[model samples]
Target: MARKEFQHYEAVSAAVPGDGAYSAAIAVKGLGAGGAPTFHRVLQDQTFKTALAADQAAVQELERLIDVTSEGELMFAQD
Candidate 1:
């Protein structure tokens, strides 16, 4: 897993085990907040062969995130 600090939030890469593969996802949470962190699944239409690959891909996608809204929304960089 990869973690990065973003203002008052901390974003981390996650690999969700599926039937035969892993799903790329990012988990974001407020640095000092109380509630559970929110999860944002990325590259939804794709699956990785390994958890490591999924985590790496999630990290890349996390890097592409421009911001995490106050309401826990993910803002992506436009192409």
Candidate 2:
């Protein structure tokens, strides 16, 4: 979906973190064809640490679910 939206815009840019951190922003030009570009910056040291940890936990949970699903294993929905 993001790719499709980017196609609508004439210009766009992106960047990825190198050292355990990442930040990027996008700029679009035009109306519904592009609209306004969004800017986002993240410094993953202090404030970003909490968010990063939460995301890692979520990924771990997903991996466990995938393992169960592959093995035809069943567990409580709450788990």
Candidate 3:
């Protein structure tokens, strides 16, 4: 049995199209056959300053969902 190497790109975003506010998985990849991949936050540059739940359970749940390494990146989107 042989296993194949696969490269996949997945992103989740939410916003009213043409609203000038959007968030997407904009992967910054280097051009050419072999390239490096990087992630960036596009648009939606708004000041998000607000207190959140002190409960650690909720925080942990969010961390589990998104592979977050930094703090204070509280992200939430609609259904």
Candidate 4:
């Protein structure tokens, strides 16, 4: 997993098991009191042949993230 910290939250890259492959995902966690953690499934239309590839893609996606909502939602820089 790859982790990135923002002003009020943190983003993590993850690889999830898919059909004969791996899928990229992002997990966002809010910082400070009353914060929550949210898992966001990314790259739904793509699958990687290896977990490492998926994780790497996820890390790239995490880097693209601009911010996190108070509700633990993710805001990406682009679609």
Best lDDT goes to which candidate?
1
Model 3: lowest-lDDT 10 consecutive positions: 1-10
Candidates in order, TM-scores: namely 0.87, 0.23, 0.22, 0.79
List model 2 lDDT by residue over 1-79, tens digit each. 0221222232233333345643332223432643444433222232223444434433333332311222223221344
Which ten-residue region of model 2 has the weakest summed lDDT?
Answer: 66-75
Between prediction 1 and prediction 2, the one with superior TM-score is: 1
Assess candidate 1 and give its TM-score to the true structure.
Answer: 0.87
The positional error of residue 44 in candidate 2, measured at the CA in angstroms, is 24
Steric clash pairs (candidate 1) = none
Q: Tell me how candidate 3 scores on lDDT.
A: 0.29
Candidate 2 stretches greater than 4 Å from native: 1-49, 67-79
Model 4, position 51, has a per-residue lDDT of: 89
RMSD of 1: 1.4
lDDT of each residue in 1-79, candidate 3, tens digit only:
1111113332222222223423332232322435544434434343122212112222332333333223313233433
Weakest ten-residue segment in model 1 by summed lDDT:
1-10
| lDDT score, candidate 4, position 30 | 64
TM match of model 3 to true structure: 0.22
